[model samples]
Target chain A: MSFAQPRYDGTSLALGQQSDEELMLAYAAGDLQAFCQLYEQHKNPLWRFFVRRGMATECAEELVQEVWQRVITSAPGYQPSARFTTWLYQIARNLLADQHRKAHRRFTLVSDESEALESMASQDYPDTITEQGRLALRLKHCLGKLPALQLDVFLLKEEAGLTMEQVATIMGAGLDACKSRWRYAVANLSKCIGMGAPADD
Target chain B: MTEEEKRLSALYQSLDKENSPEHVDARILAMAKQGALVHTVPLDVKQPSRWTAWRWPLSSVVSAALLVGILFFTTSPLLPPEEQAVSASSYDMVPSAPKQARREYQAMPEQKRQLAQSIEREAAAARSKTASVLPAAQISERLAEVDRLVASGELQQAGTLLMSLVEEAPEAKARLSEGQLALLQEALHRRSTNQ
Candidate 1:
C-alpha cells in the first residue's frame, strides 16, 4: 500500500495540495473539503493495512469506519506536532491491538508453508495468472506466519509508508528493533516465497 | 533494502489494490459533513474584527451601568408632594445632608432652578407656621433600631416603634429611603398577618 502524493483538482485545488498536517488542521477547523480530500487519500491504504494483517473484510471495514470516526471526533484536539499518517496509523494500530486483545484469535497463522503451497498448486492457476501471481498469494500466507511484532513492523513500514523511526514510534519499539524486525520479515517472507536468504548477506 | 526485498515489496504492491467498500466511504463522508455543521466556527477563517470582538463586553458594561442607575434612582428617598417644597429648601439649610441633593441641584437646568427658588420661598414662609421636627441624624438612629427589631423578629415591637416615629415626626418617612420604608412596611404587614 503506497501512500500516494495528494493530487489536486477542481475547486479544492488549494486545500487538496496542502500537506497532510495542514489538511488535518483545516479539517479540525471544520473544513469538510479538506477532510474529504484527506479521507480519499488514505482510506484505501488504511483499509488494506488491516486487510493484509488477516482482518476479515467486514472487520476491516468496521475498523476503517471507527478510525475515521475517531479522526473526526478528535479533530478539534488535533495539533500539527507530527505527520498526519503517523497519527492515523497509531489509531489503526491501537484499534487493531484492542481487537486482538478482545478476540485472542488474530495471532494464529491460518496456514503452514505446506498447506499454502499445496493449496496454491491444487487451485488450477488461470492461464493469465503470471508466475509472480502465485508467489503473491504464497507471500500473503507467509505474512500470516510472521511473529505478531515483526508483521506489525513490516506492515507499518511498508503499508503506511512510515520511516523506521516512525514505525518504531507507532509500534512502541526501538528503531534498531523495528529495522531488525523488518529485515527478519523480509527474509522470512523471501524464504516462504522461495527467494531464499537476501543475496546481499 | 536489498534487491530481494525490493522485489518482494513490488509483489506485495501488486496484491494491495483493495479499497474500503463504497458504502463505508459514503457513511464516513456523510459523518464528516454532519460534524462540520456542528462545529460552525472555523478557527482558520472569518476572524472577528476588533469591534465585533469587543461588542459583547461593551454591551455587558453598559447593561451593568444601567442596572446600577435604575437601582439607585428607584431606591433613593422620595419626598411626598407637600415635602418636596420644604425638602428643596431644607437641602440648602442642612449642609450635612446627603450631597446627592446638592449635586442634583447643581446639575438641574435653569428652569428647574427657578422652580426650586420659588418653592424655597414658599417653604421658608411655611416654616414659621409649623413646629420644627426631629433632625435627620435622630431619624436615622430610630430607623437603625427598627432594622435591629426586624432582624430579631420582634415585628410587634418594631411596628409600634415605627408608627410612633411616623406620628411624632411626620417628616421621618421623607428621610427614610424607599428601600428602608418598604422593609419597615413589610415587617408591620407580617405582624398583622401573624395575628
Candidate 2:
C-alpha cells in the first residue's frame, strides 16, 4: 500500500497485556506460544475475509494455508511498523490479487443494476431454506454485484473489522477514497437486499 | 453510524457463522507448529555443531596471532629485511576473510609493501646514527692498528690512537654491537698489558 503507514513508538503496552504487534515480535523471536495465541485470535476473521470475497471453500482453505505459511516464513523480517491486522490483511489482499491475475478473473463492476436484481429474483429457494439462509444468499449475490474495489472496502471494514485508516493503509487507497467506496458498497448492498431502501448518502 | 448501516452490520454478523473446516485448522496449526519449532531451534535453542562450537574462539585466536605477527614483522630488528618481507607476503596470502572483507584485504599487499619500506627506513636511520660520526670500516681499521701497534711495542702511540678514536666518535660505543665492542676492549687490554 502506498498510503503513509503508521509508526510504532518505542513505548510498549504493560506486561501481560501484549498487543498484536508484541505477539508478532515474540513470534519472530521464536515464541511458539505467542504464535499459537495469535493464530487462535485471527483465524476465523481471516477465513471469513477470504470466503466473503467469493473464493470457493477449497480455494479459500488453500489461500488461508498459504497466508499463514507466508506469515511464518516472513516472521523473521516482520517489524512492528503497523498494526498486525493491517499487515495480515495486506498479505491476504496481495495473494487474492495474485490469484485473480492467475485466474484472469479480475472482478469488474456490475454493468447493470437490474441484472443483479434479476439474478436475485431468478434464484429458486428450497421450501426448507430458512429466512436467514435466504438473506445470506441475497447478501452474497449483492456482494458479487458490487465493483471489486467497493467489495474489498466493505469486506475489509465489516469482515476484518478494520478502521477506515487501516483499510486505506491495506488497500493503498486514500482514506477519503476508502470511506467513499465503503459507503457505496453499503448503499448498494442495502438496496439489493431490500433492507428498507438504501440510506441517503 | 447511521441506523441503516447498523442494521446491515447486524445482519451480516448474524450470517457470518462460517468456521474454517477442522481439517484446515489442523493443517494450519501443524504449519504454525513446524514454523515455530524451526524458528526456536535455529536461534534460541540450537544444538551447536562441532565447528560451530569452536568457530568463535578459533577465529579470535587467529585474529590475535595475525595482528601480533604483523606488528612484530613490521617493527622488530632481530628479523632480517628479507625474512621480514617474506613474512609480510605470507600474511598477505592468507585467504581467511569473507568476499567483502577480502576486497578490503586486497589493499593489504600495498600496505605490507609500505610497512616493509618503513622498516627499511628505520634500519637505515639506525645505521646513519653510527655512520654520521665515522665510517664503520675506518673504525675497524683503527682498532686493528691499535692491536698492531701494541705488538710492535709502541705502547704510548697505541694508547694515544685509541683515546683519539673514543673522543672523535663518542656515540659510536653506544651504537656498536656487543661483538664489535668486545673486540675494541680486547685490543685496549692488549695495549695495557704491553704497557
Candidate 3:
C-alpha cells in the first residue's frame, strides 16, 4: 500500500493525459511530471477548500502543504480501490478535523461588523469586478456562520468539484445526509446574502 | 435546486482562487525525489557483500597458514632421540639448528687433542670418518714429510711419522712409494740387529 514508492512502472501510459488515479500511481513511483500535473490540477481547489472554511491564508497554506505532504508520504501505500480524489480529499478532511479538534471550534466566525467591513474595505473594488468581489466578500462573511458539517459539504462540492456521492464518501456519511447538509448550507448562505430563504422541499 | 441556488454555488466558486505557496511545492517535490531513490536501493546488502569481498583473500591466508602448519609438524620429528625424549623439548615446533651445534660442542672438546688420540688409537675408524671430510692437499703434505724422513735415514722418525699418517687417514697408506717402504723395512731390520 505505497502512497509514493520509488517509481510505479505499473503502466507505461503518457502522464500528461493520464487519469488522476494513473497520475497518482505514477507519482507514487517517483515520476516527477505526474506529481506536478496532479499538483496543478488540485492546488487551487485544495487552497480554496481551506480558505472557504474560514482558515486564514497562512493557516490554509500550511494545511494545503500538509495535505500534499501526506500524499507524498503515503504514496507507497496508495490503493486504487477508491478514486484518487476521494483519497486526496479524505486527507484534507482529516487534517481539517484535527485542526478543529485542537481549536475546539469549527472555524472563527466573521463576528465583528467592523472587521468584515474593514476586510472588504481594504481591497480594491472596481465596476462589476468590484461588485462581485463585494458580494463574494459579503457571502464569505455569512459562510463563517453556517454549521460546520453543512459548510464542509458545500465547500467540498464547489471547491473540490466533488460529486454528492464523493462528498458523502469523504464526510463518511450517507448520501442523503450529505444532501441535507448542502441544502442547509446553501439556504443559510443565500439568506445571509439577501436572497430569500430556500423553498421547502 | 433553483437557479438562485445554482447562482449561489457558482458565485461561491468564483469567490476565491487562492494558490499554494511556492515553498510547499518545492518541499513536497524534494521529498518525493528522495523517496524515489530509496525505492531502488537495497539497504541490508552491504554487510554481506563486505564479508564476501574479503572471502578470497581470507581463504588464501588460511591456506598458507595450513601449509606452514603441515610443514612444521612433518619436520618436527627430525630432533634426535635424546632431544625427542625430553618432555619440555617436545613442545618446540621449530628445533633450532644453532642449539644442536651447541649440544655437539658440549660433547666434543674445544681443541683437537681428544680427536687426535681417538684417531691414533683406531686408525681404521678415523680413516672411515675422515674419508669424506679432509681435503686431498693436507694428505699429500703428510706423505712428502714421511719420504723426507726415510731419505735422511731417520728410521725411528720415519716409522713414527708413518703411524701418525695412517692414524690421520688410513687411506694415506697407499700414498707411500715402494722405495720409501723398503727404506723403512731396512731401518727396522738394522734396529733389530743392533738390539
Q: Each candidate's DockQ score against the native complex? A: 0.47, 0.37, 0.32
Query: TM-score of each model's B chain?
Result: 0.28, 0.24, 0.38
List candidate 2 stretches off by more than 4 Å: A1-16, A118-136, A196-201, B43-195
lDDT of 2: 0.76
Give the distance in Å from residue A79's predicted Cα in candidate 3 to where it truly belongs: 1.2
lDDT tens readout by residue for model 1, B57-114: 9999999999999999998768786668566655655476568977787788989877
* Backbone atom clashes (below 3 Å) for every candidate: 0, 0, 15
- Ranked by TM-score, the better of candidates 2 and 3 is 2
TM-score of each: 0.55, 0.56, 0.53
Q: Which residue runs of candidate 1 sit more than 4 Å off their true CA positions?
A: A1-13, A106-128, A197-201, B41-195
- Superposed by TM-score, candidate 2 places the C-alpha of residue A81 at a distance from the truth, in angstroms, of 0.6
Q: Is the docking of candidate 2 incorrect, acceptable, medium or high quality?
A: acceptable
Error of 3 at A120 (Å): 12
DockQ agreement of candidate 2 with the native complex: 0.37
User: What is candidate 3's lDDT per residue for B64-98, written digit by digit as tens?
Assistant: 99999999998877767754544233234125537
iRMSD values, candidates in order: 1.1, 1.6, 1.9
